[model samples]
Target: MSAPAREVRDVARAALAWASGRRADFALGEDALAADGQVDRSWKPLGELAQVCATVTRHTPPGDPLHARAADLLAFAWRQTGEGELFLRLQRLEPFATYPLEVYAALAAAGFRHPAYEAATATVARTRGWRLTEQEPTRRLGVLHAEERGGIHRDEPREPALRRTWLGGLPEPWTFERSAGYALTHVVFHLTDWGRAAGGVPGDLTDYLAHWLPPWIDTCLDARMWDLACELLAVAASVPGLPGDTVPDDAWARVAAAQDASGALPEEGDAGDPAAYFAHHYHSTLMAAFAAALTAGQGVPV
Candidate 1:
């Protein structure tokens, strides 16, 4: 069966309505300054809207019409959420078909796609911008995640690798692949890095990853980010001796052996193929729990 042609207009409208109200707290009025001088409720609306965009983007299938529209929405919301890196990253990832229809409708209906959106996303090299460089190598490495180039030598600069780096020390370009290769390598690399930094042991890797992941995740309202977090967690479990992995099968049973000893099981019916699951559904829920746990000084089981 074929995919829908995308209710490109509808998605664009949704994105706009969600984004339009984000600045009131940061507006010129009294609300902008909470006397405490911190950016107040301004962040809440923006964070909520960014999650909505991420939710839509996570559920929409790649190559679907709405998918591209959602990507543009993802871009806009990321700006509102103050995560310009994710905004530009997602903008660069927005497929071509979603642009003409989605962006056009948004431009027609809503002045311009957010003032900050344009400024931040203006320079992404789309298909129109793909350029062949003559200053480099002879070998071709096929496709890339966030860069315009197709090939890289073994000794190539690590800058491109750094662009997609985010939560749990995994890079988006690598993590987005959702493969055993990406998962295993990603966890191992981070574990190794964390372990090495902690005098070549696992003593404090959890603290570092836990401490570093949330802020790096920025507005963890997006569902995709949450799903990514789960995958990372699962990857951690798969490692030979992490808490979740090291614990025997009986340990989880024991953890759940007494109702009083265990917290409620994650509101049921979440099991599925982790790689194939829609990122939007599980991302926010996962992050919310993760955040709540962090606030209460808890940790994921490996």
Candidate 2:
């Protein structure tokens, strides 16, 4: 393999090792509590873990130990609770928030088939409406999640036009502003299904990302926003016709360097105290693993 590909594979292997070791936490629900003492009383932890495992398995070859482990873990998590209970808990926690929908979408993408997920999503659509179609691009990615993962399909023929308008309204002259960078990455994620469904992204939006993504990745790296930087790597991996080899040599390297020996990458650039390790690092490490898997699997047909 080429140097960059090899680097991504190495990082992916390390992340898989780390994630596999956390199976106990995942199984026993210990990963549900945040460092701030806020417990994820909903299905967020299981959903997130399922998403990570699904994404990893998608890029991994069959018979690969990591792939089999991820699949097994996903099944285990699914069996722990029913979709109806999870959705009901999520509704009680935040009925109007977009996160529940996103979580459901991730589960669906991972091949966790549940009628309750579809029913809950449909109910939310009927009650909450398709805010993603009407709202700003940055705020409505969860809606895109609903659409892409078979949660709620919009029947409007003007969908492409709507996408164009939304893409056009995004703040231009992208800077190192942390929130903006984060939003841009999410915009790309919504457009590309976190790099797994790049073909569906509109051409203009894809072109826009192609132009601005490289410099934005550099800027985020310079600012020590490692989490956002990894997200940008995911965006790069998603753009079609964009050369797989064009990914910056150091992008994966920087994230890998920040990873603890235990396999967690910090939210920012530094690992915080031990007390906050799972809360601060879990999502970032997951994103890094996702980026690494996506990058390493590049050039192979999806």
Candidate 3:
């Protein structure tokens, strides 16, 4: 039910290799550069690449091949944002929109800095409007963490925010559904700082997840929902005392099997429409890399 560290490291390297080869595709389009046009297509993907690659670089030390490649990919992703200037420009263009800051947080946490963006964001953070911005519970947690990552103080408390989330409530296990699954995983991600702060997950929720995550992951796998399944796997890896028991041998094997030889993972059972491949499956592939890096970084033999 397990593989050596190198096996999981191979998974991490392959996924980053694939991402590095596709680096150009993650660039900001002309429209996105000028305005908020096609953000989901342009900005979101780029941000995700930065986030996952940053995690890979953080977990893998400098000498390792995986670390070197992941660092290269992370640097490439940073360039796509014009070396942090683009985020500053976007902050001006969409003062209320938090995506730019949220995306910037990944790089910021990885030691990439943008003084102008930080100053502007700090000014905004002091506004009453910023504090009162309406957001779903999970996203609210995201913004709070983003502010924290950038060293901008938000006059808000996190515990109350946690108590408001779907995962925070420790909701009925059977009521779990697709949208709710993503919500819960993100809750874990934000709570644990995407596995950097494993103890951040409350003990009760840790126990709750230890009991429920396996079946939840199985359900995603059963539905052939590779993306969410990978996300759920990431949740398992992020929680303290969960990885050894929660991540089943077959779960990693199934996810690994779904990965293309080129390292892209399909959203579902298979990679559909080769012509639009990366567009269709980029997030899932990124999730696979994210999960793999976290799994391996924890020193768990997957």
Q: Find the candidate with the highest TM-score and give its number.
A: 3
Model 3 lDDT vs. the true structure?
0.84
Deviation of model 1 at 183, angstroms? 14
Best candidate (score: lDDT)? 3
lDDT per residue as tens, model 3, 1-302:
34645556666767778888888888888888566498888889988988887887777778878788878877887887889999888888888889999889998877889899999988888888988899998999999998999879755788898889999999999999989899999998898887777689888888899899998998899888999998998888778787465766677777877888998888888989999898878899889889888988777653
Give the worst 10-residue stretch by lDDT in candidate 3: 1-10
Candidate 2 stretches greater than 4 Å from native: 24-42, 88-98, 128-136, 147-150, 156-170, 174-176, 243-246, 300-302
How many steric clashes between backbone atoms does each model show? 2, 0, 0
TM-score of each: 0.23, 0.81, 0.95
lDDT for each residue of candidate 1 in 1-302, tens digit (9 for 90 to 100): 11111122222333233233332422223332233423323433333333334433433446645346545655564444344333333344453212222222222222223344333333433324423322111011111211211111133443343323332243333243334323332333333321111222233434443443333232221332333443343334323334323222222222122111112112123334546332222232322222222211113321
Q: Write the per-residue lDDT of candidate 2 for residues 1-302, one digit (tens) a residue.
A: 67666667767777767767776555535333223323353355656677777777887888877688778777766665564355555555555656556666776787766676566666766653444446664555546565558457765443543454434454475444777666666766666666676586667666676677777788777777878888888778767776544456687777778888988788886887888777677677777878877775666332
Where is model 1 more than 4 Å wrong at Cα? 1-37, 57-112, 115-302
Steric clash count of candidate 3: 0
What clash pairs does model 1 have? 141-151, 226-283
Worst 10 residues of 2 by lDDT: 30-39
